[model samples]
Target chain A: MTATAAPFRAKRVLPGFTLSLGTTLLYLVLIVLIPIAALILKGAEIGPAAFWAIVSSERAVAAFRITLTAAAIATAFNAAYGLLMAWVLVRHDFPGKRILDALMDVPFALPTAVAGLSLTALFSANGWFGQVLHPAGIPVVYTIWGIALAMAFTSIPFVVRTVQPVLEDLDPSLEQAAETLGATPWQVFTRVVFPAILPAWLAGCTTAFARSLGEFGAIVFIAGNLPFETEIAALLAYIRLEEYDYNGAAAIALVLLGFALVLLIVSNILQSWAARHREATR
Target chain B: MSAPDMIAPGSAATGHGRPARTMGARALIGLAVILTLLIVVAPLVYIFARAFSEGWQVYASNILDPAMLHAIWLTSLVAVIVVPLNIAFGIAAAWAVAKHRFPGRGVLVTMIEIPFSISPIIAGICYLLLYGRQGLLGPWLGEVDLQVMFALPGIVLVTMFVTAPFVAREVLPLMQAQGTAQEEAAVTLGASGWQVFRRVTLPNIRFALLYGAVLCTARAVGEFGGVSVVSGNIRGQTNTLPLHVELLFNDLNAVGAFAAASTLTVIALVALILKAVLEGRRG
Candidate 1:
């Protein structure tokens, strides 16, 4: 057959749009949108007072405070600690450097429950690290400190993973330029390098913060899950579900979802800023 | 560190910084390593401590217990299905987004990240609403004898939702970095589109695909919230190891929960090792 020339030809300017779009729609329809829509539909069944009373109870309020506060504290710790880890991994080399770098991913790979247990084992009164800290009068396990520890364990990798790539992309000459202009090392880091990666650092911190708020498997072992004390939001939801309180569970979940969505907005802004920085340097 | 074949040839020399001009850099690195050791290394040792506390006999018994074995088997089953299915989804999504400039490409990408951002428990509730006895699809599923929630299908579905983005996220970046040159070349050489994808595109993205699968499987195995919410956490039936840990914890078998958790952690350690080695190779 001879090739026919037409005034308008469908040249397929974008590669594989039809095929990819088909698959994406299928996946999202089956996996995400449908399920989430289900959740909204279910919540629509409950009365407003029932939703409020279950979620707003003193015990539930206490759980929310415990979970949200611990998550914030953990995220703040990672913001500082993860940046330091990222700085070391990105900027320095020593013996077993690769091993140390590998260690950063432990939080990502390790299950939360195991992380909690291991942390507990090390910090319990009878454990190795606990024995050292006992005389110093620091209690870790069976407390909010343990909850924070679990969150920190799971949250560390988020900040490190996010910040590591940004740091690697950061040009050092800018910092040198700052240093040569009479900035001290601390001043150079704070004023120059830190500012550049701050958005990404904030993005990572928010992700960690959101994750710790929802984290359950790891914290359960260490948190002691005491109502109005060590109990967290997710654990409260679990307890509500255990008591067959579906409305209560949904209300708490909706609250967590609200927080997660807010954090998402913040991270989205930070991500775009990161992208702009990359483009400018490129 | 000296694995010559894996890393880009001579990247060390190029990427390596000059020796620290000041002592501050030295101390900072030193301090970071110590903290990392304190945080990461010490706890991992304790996982071994909990597992091997009573030595070989105890470890053998704890590990060989039927419940632990079942948890491992169930987790494996979840991983087996979740990884392959997600890989397919990832490839499809990545291919579409990377290869196309659609009207909703940005929206679609954002949608893909919903799984990662939303709590898994919320995901479970989503399915419960859609397919539970009182769910929207409940009548339809009942008419057809299909059970979506409180079953294995529910577990698989939620896990899939949670991990759906991993491979696509990994492959999309690599594909974007490489652009469409090779595929175009393959088509020019009389290769069919399918042939081009299989022989050229597949090989190029294989490493990212595997990397994504590893991450996906690790997550699927560790999944608790989504699975727990949908699964009903039935012991010996619906209990994945994470669920089992919670069950034991509730039962006041703290040691048993720790033991079960160690099993998952050990798997995580192996996976983490594999991931690092693979990433090291890729870098």
Candidate 2:
């Protein structure tokens, strides 16, 4: 502790601790923290009763239900599609595989507004996909299904990207041993392969679900945005803000923020658990 | 371990020449290809198709419209300003969190990721609450006569928030895995902090940095919900490309909307190509 002995930081090898950490902290506080704090402070100013009143309104309730349900449907679809994609990309070899892999990232790279517009066009009565489905008496535009489709489109990559590496690293000998033990392919997957990828799969789904929950640009175009139906919580918040009801907007936003925070925490926990599980198996 | 692991997934008893297994593999691949075509490829093709629905002349006219040009310029302006600032933030955050251990290191990592979870629309609302006319800082901002909301600054700030994590997320894992040994060696050899980073660290993380920058640029240019909230949606002023597309669509100009959207679609394609190239190089 003596000055002559040098302080702990002084003896440390890496320099720029203060400089680097300071920059990080200053940016986070200015760009990230303060703005979020404004929202929280606004929520606080509204008080508990008023906030509850706004969030519990029937329209608000409907928006929440729709967002959650559509997100759930999107996540479910991604779970199956993503797993299959991951498995195929890692386990099979085929021509154009590389191109297909790159295609998987289109949702992430594409602008949400663009995605919404194209999806709306494709599903409209006169559009390509719509022309076929419309005659079959199945309409997609301005419905919850369309909302789910948009969510699915934007979040398609989350599960595939997360699970691909894990599947790639899976030990073949373990599957071989299961096969030698008189196990069918189904049993091998269920008993050995599925267990191994389960944690990563779940982590991916959680993130996909979170992404779907926050989706806005894409859904608005396709959802038809009818109140109490296709309108999502994010759009509802925007609507509140547009009408100059800051309190109402803040209330709905606070709830959405809470859900996001919870999901983020859950996803982080699941990811770490997956990492530890991988380490254990290795 | 590494060599076997690389071969294991592809070489495993996955297909085994069994008819049932071979059929299963083909079926799964077919399903994946078809689903991807429908879900991902269709919309992409549709963007271009609808963009040129009225022929290339109309598409060209839509893209060349003064309002469309302004939106493009504003979007580019935001991306130009936001990307460099975010890259710096990303480097500093990654350097701090990876090169050194601190009490709240984990918490800092989590905070950096806060934007990803929160809706971009919420981010816009947050800024509006902070800087809008009746916002928390509105009075003081008025006293100072500085406008944040409904201006370029608001658009840039919200875009920055939405994209802040991209570079750091890309660079951090690589930094952590590479360890601090090389940096420590550089320090012992009388190199300054900046020298060590520039000489030793920069080369190591350059690909990841580029990957992150590409992703950040795409996100910044395409950011809708947050920018929409703050930009005030003034035609030919605060409007971005995404917002312009929406405006055109709302005005019953679907062809113009798709034409505007097609430009973004090309950007997205370029980003995906760059990402794939970088991924291969990094590996």
| Candidate that scores best on lDDT | 2
Candidate 2 C-alpha lDDT tens digits along A1-282? 356536556657898888998999999999999999999999999999999999999999999999999999999999999999888887787877778777887887899999999999899999999999999988999999999999999988888877777776677788899999999979998999889888888888988898899999999899989999889999999999999999999999999899888887787777787788888776
The whole-model lDDT of each prediction reads: 0.77, 0.88
Pairs of residues at least 3 apart in sequence or in different chains that clash in candidate 2:
none
**What digit string (tens of lDDT, one per residue) describes model 1 on residues B64-119?**
77887887788889889989889988989988878655467788888888777787
Question: Per-prediction count of colliding residue pairs?
Answer: 1, 0
TM-score of chain B of 1: 0.89
Interface residue Cα RMSD of candidate 2 after superposition:
5.9
Indicate the residue-level lDDT of B52 in model 1: 69
Query: Mind giving the per-residue lDDT tens digits that candidate 1 earns over A1-282?
Result: 113422112444334555766888998998898877766655677767877887789998999889888888898889889888778777776666677767777787777667776787788888899999877899888889889989988878777767676677778898889878999888988888887887777778878887788787778778888898899888888777777676777778877877877877787887778768766663
